[model samples]
Target chain A: MTTMTSNALCFGDEFPASGAPCFVQVDGDGLTITVESEGDDGAGEAVPFSALTVSAGGLDHDHLVVKWTRVQGERTLYLKSPDVIRAFRETVPNHLSLPFAQAAEQVQQVRHRRRLVWSLVSGAILAMVLGLWFGSDLFVELAVSWIPVEWEQKLGESAYRDFLSHQEVMKEGPAVTALGEMTHRLTEQIPNNPYRFEVTVVKSDVVNAFALPGGYVVVFTGLMKKAESGEEVAGVLSHELNHVLQRHGLERIVKSLGLLTVAAIVLGNQQGLVGMMNQLGVELLTLKFGREQETEADLTGLQLLQRAKIDPSGMIRFFERLSEKDQGRMEWLSTHPMSTARAERLKAELAALPKKSPEPFTFEWKQVQTSLGSQPVAAP
Target chain B: MKSEILYPGAFPMVRVDLAAGEHIKAESGAMVACSPTIDIESKMEGGFLGALSRKFLTGEKFFFQTLRASRGPGEVLLAPTVPGEIVILELDGVNEYMVQKDGFLAGADGILIESKMQSLSRGLLGGEGFFILKISGKGMLALNSFGAIHKIELKPDQEYIVDNSHLVAWSSTTSYSIEKATSGWVASFTSGEGFVCRFRGPGLVYIQSRNPGSFGAWIRQFIPVSE
Candidate 1:
């Protein structure tokens, strides 16, 4: 009935004392167990193979544990020889012997799953750290992209407040009116602006004009005095307006403070934005936009002048006069430095300029200059 | 042999109708239900030593069941343990296919399953490299993947990139090389795509849409860990 049938030593409850263990034999019907007690009673019993099941124990030892489940309680036969289990397994093929692999598989699955989870968590954190390490510019851009328009306006207003606190804001006056009319002429052509147009003449001798966030364009008196014609003044104002239109102030803040810091400051605490104002330094006013930003502003400024029907040649003339006057040391030159390639690009663009019958100045330039002299100002 | 895919993609099962005297060799315990006419016999194939090596080395079952249609044409339903899609590839003894180790489901009698070793570097430092199971000879071989299987045909001089973990099976004619997903050190480490297998082919490569490794991580989040 089976292949490897032989006599072997086994343990059973029937034998009180052991002599030579037991002689277990396999037959067609069942296992024949021969046992001897101390009182000289030698008896044997037969168990059908179906009435028993194997305990598939750990693999460290050489033994086969047969657990009998058909009985009332449970009885076991531990055959000392390990090869008997293989012999027993091959006889009753289907669902007879436990391979121990099934239990091992379950243990492997759990251990592997935990290791897999930890590896993935560690990998994700490593990737995030490396992402921040290799490309912080990418993070800054991503953070900047997440900034809502409302937050941008709020940041702009804060920067404007910081700069304005250090200077005079010429509120309502004939000077403000003249400045407003000129800017309005240039701004009207811009479709859908996000800013409220307000021009302030700060009584400073910097000979420079700067645009604040949220459409606050501040021009210095020194620049107004230096202008040869109303077009020259319009040229400088138009350039400054381009800076405001492009939200350069906010971009600078985002670039300087780093995206993570800005994100924490702008998105987290309410006072975060204002608290970061100190790092902005005086660079907000003397802040020189990148060469790309300068070129973009110059080109955009030219378009604004065209829309207002003002001669764009005035922008070129202002640059030529300043570059000729000094190589360095001028405040405006320090911030908005002119390069030869920039001047060449402007000249080339001017050569292809369309013929426009530009309208004349509707406001008196001298009266606006005199109003600034008069100082008839009020709180805005 | 005639076969049909039942409820593919989500819960896939292959229903094969075998004519009289026809037989199918399937992974042990893969049978869900079968017709009464079909007789099942289990054996430790390739003898005792081979069976022991197959069990211990590859972590696959040593015993396989051969379900034969005895009296008349009968049906046998077979599926893998995991939820995935199953596909059958027919061979005429002229070609062979190398599949992922655990991808084997059920196949016709003539096909042989064997272990294939990768190159030393790939074998030692690869996702599924140590032992890749190969199915060859002349028969229909069924394969299972973690997700919907997608077939990509590559012409000469054309190469397709795939994540190594998602690879199911590919034509033996295709040449492949393993490389980091990107050349940059930081990007290679940080991009999360990791290593990729680039296959240059004049044949087909079957890929799974989802990677089982990533799916396991996603599933791990919802599982409760006991202290």
Candidate 2:
């Protein structure tokens, strides 16, 4: 076989400052290194394959370094050429190639381990995010249950006053009396209710009504104009009142303000709780209930109407009529996402209830609508 | 300038005797005492940006106190903030040294200190952070350790594993990578040695006997916390 010769730098104890340039070639069972000289070949050192240990060196870790012991001290041969490394690996005995094999395996293992660590870390973060998402919902529910009705009344009272501050409220008109009559019917139906219901009829044409926590309900004059009967108006009242009964408004506040505020309430920080309530009082008007809360309020409101012996069909008819109209400028439809599915679900619940003849209210629906003085409206 | 370490092991100080017009740079606030002939000036080494990078990236001080014997030969004593041993490394203008933060106590005028960014793995897991101080050029450099400094000289292709937190400084020729202390990950953490630096050497590595992080944690339990 042709001698595979390559240029190499040999470092020894004698030449510590700089290594000597030499030619390395594979010999029988070992390697022979010949020091380069002019016109003369110096006697070279013969190193057995068994005596050498191979490792990677250099700043970029591309150079192949072979180290062995000599009588003077330890010697190192640095080889940078890929050709030389290939030749060395091809010619060296299996035992000598073992170190190179092990080094390559080590690199593979490190890469694999890093990949494993990255995936594990990412998985942990994902799990934490999911846990916090679901856990916080449960936490909000638990916190809402602990809140006293008295505190809710105070919270609702402040928000109620803030809401009515800008609106023209019809305190003693036929519209206000009609709303009071509806409120009384709904409140009387709720058993063991902690709230003393306070309903107001605000003068606006937005066909909207909302309930604050602890029985503070507001009905717009446009809604009375839109209704054909007192039971239809009472349907809206029943829905809003159930929002207070189920404490949906309070749930929205607690969820929006976040867990820190809930923790403060749990820890009995009354002053901080009061401060948060005052700040959130105006925000309560625009707070939108979640889809689940809306559905719960809808179904429970039907049950409340049924228990009070008022017609449950009126609530479904009002919802269906609102849903059919162009939703723009309809604040109630916008806040309460009017869907055909909701009307169908209400109809299904009404069918499930035992049949009863509903009691009619004593107010004239047309007179209540005309009392607002904006226009003489047609019966829906 | 000539220098010697007095009180070698514990509470060590480097006493430097500088000839006229000779100067040495030390970590700011390192000077304990100095003669009247020695003029001290705080210098932003390597100009503004260099000093800023070293200060912010490597956690080194922005200013280096330059003590010059302007009038005549004067003696100045310098000590590190932490009570520990001091080592003097003689650079040959060829090899560079990677020093940990707070390791530099004092150095001759010929030595150049600059911040170097380590690789991501070395930065995140090696415990040396992202930036380390690179000392180069020919000069005598004084390094202070949090505890006694132990030097390990390795032969070609030889290897040694060192706890990351105990590392003080190492020759740039020495290659190292951070790895788990034990074969098993759980065992590595349970052993209280999470990551260690495995160094492949044809050079020297210096490590401290004590870990400052563990010492601080141990001392924290005794201190009373105010509400």
Candidate 3:
């Protein structure tokens, strides 16, 4: 072993954490600290000067935190005054100094490099967050396109089943059969229609009509009762059909829950609609289409009605009647724009389109109304 | 510069006394009181881009407030938004320390504040945030935490583990890894003990008794929702 040369001796032994009396013996020019353990055994260990890094505890420092190799617990020594700090500083040679101000110079150089590294990292993180946010919409849309039409139809069936459990349904009635025939006749006109549509007339007084994620067109008896003619009922159904065809509900689900959750549900047990709708029904039931989406549905539904030789004016007339009647429970219209704005906007939109000869559509409207078990409520 | 923790417990405040020409940098919105002789100047730290980076990555304010005793020794008071204790950590330049992103309140001059982004894998595996605030150089650094700060002195060949959200700061000498507190992911999640920080010593670590995340979540429930 190479003999270490230094000045200090028993530096750690003199200062006991419990303030116990200890003695030190100097052996050579090299300072080897022999720490006498405070235990009853009075054991001692030799510590070399190089194994220690001393901190002078500064001018106003309360205590000194001296790092000595192999020592456990607190090694802090209380500084009585500035003289004690200077005295402690004098113990270590200039080359072995650990003063605050002197060490600050070397740390500054390293800190400069660290600042540069952090700035770049921050910039990269910001860019990553923005990219993920913007790219997500396009990415999710593309993924949604790959989902099979069969899954959507199952989802709709599940939602319809959940709705029936939650409320009353008018299944297998003349009213439901008539509404089903009208929906099928209208749906036949759309070439390559992807959905197997089913219209259910729910036996409730709520003046609302909505389209589930799939092709389930849910029309309340109140909606049929409130309608003045068969064409008005057809107009509402056509609007709901557009919502299903455009996959707006699925788009919203992807946006809210993200691709991961959708993928999880898809990859999970495919036990029909209850598996999906049981978890997602609340959010989807109150799903509000944005202004842009509402406009798309309005314009697209108008074109579908026109192609089926049905007068698109029935769409505007039904909206105007709802506006004047001030019926607030229409979930279909509740999430859209203000009633007056929608009414005026739809009327203006119809005026811009080219005039097409619309057939005066006729059906057993009074018979369907009688089957609904209510007269049309007059606008007061 | 001389620093003292007034109250020294929950709701503790830092009172820093700056000598002539001495300066102190503090987190923005932390200053509650200051002597009239002290000049408070706010500027972008390390220049504009540096400040912007800190703002984005560390959630620090765009401007770092510097209090200087230009003429004579003056005092400034600093406090954090939450009710907590503050610790005055004195460094002699032998080591550097890492602090939780929101733990640092103020520091004596010559103390450089920088942020470090942890590896993505570590961040995903642990509860500690992606970025950690590093206080380096020679000076006093004040750290704030909910409730009182408990300092743990770790010995060599010993490993200490702390909940990630409860950990506030640790000495630079300690090597640490972000890890799961429990053996399995299912057990970790179900037990409500997720990720924790495992520190190997010999060094010091400061932790708070209460977690700010849980406290914030508790407070959030009582707040009224606005349309």
DockQ of every predicted complex: 0.01, 0.10, 0.03
Two-way TM-score contest, 2 vs 3, winner? 2
Model 2: per-residue lDDT, tens digit, A310-333?
Answer: 998998888888788773467888
Error of 2 at A321 (Å): 17
Q: Tell me the TM-score of each prediction against the true structure.
A: 0.42, 0.59, 0.46
> What ranking of all candidate models by TM-score puts the best one first?
2, 3, 1
Interface RMSD of 1: 26.8
Question: Looking at model 3 chain B, which ten-residue stretch has the lowest summed lDDT?
Answer: B119-128
| Reference-based lDDT, residue A350, model 1 | 69
Q: What is the interface RMSD of each candidate, in Å?
A: 26.8, 6.2, 11.2
lDDT of 3 by residue, A1-380 (tens): 11222112112333421122222222322122323234334333444446545443221122343445454533322222344345545565554564534543444544565567667877899988987778776776787787787766665666677777887877677677668766866897889988888788888877788888878778888888888877788888998899889888888877887766766665666674345667777777777876767778888888788777777888778877776656757654576544677767777877877778876544577877887778755544
Tens digits of per-residue lDDT, candidate 1, A1-380, equal 22223244333343221112345666665676654222134446577877776542211122344556434544455454445544554565455534434533554564566568667866999999999888665666566666776666655566677777889777777656767778888989888886776677888766888786667778887777666657878888998888878766667767776656656755776565456755443546556687777888888898789888998888888887877776233688777887878888887876777768778787777777676674322212
Candidate 2 versus the native: TM-score? 0.59
List clashing residue pairs in candidate 1.
none
Q: Is the docking of candidate 2 incorrect, acceptable, medium or high quality?
A: incorrect
Model 2 lDDT at residue A309: 90
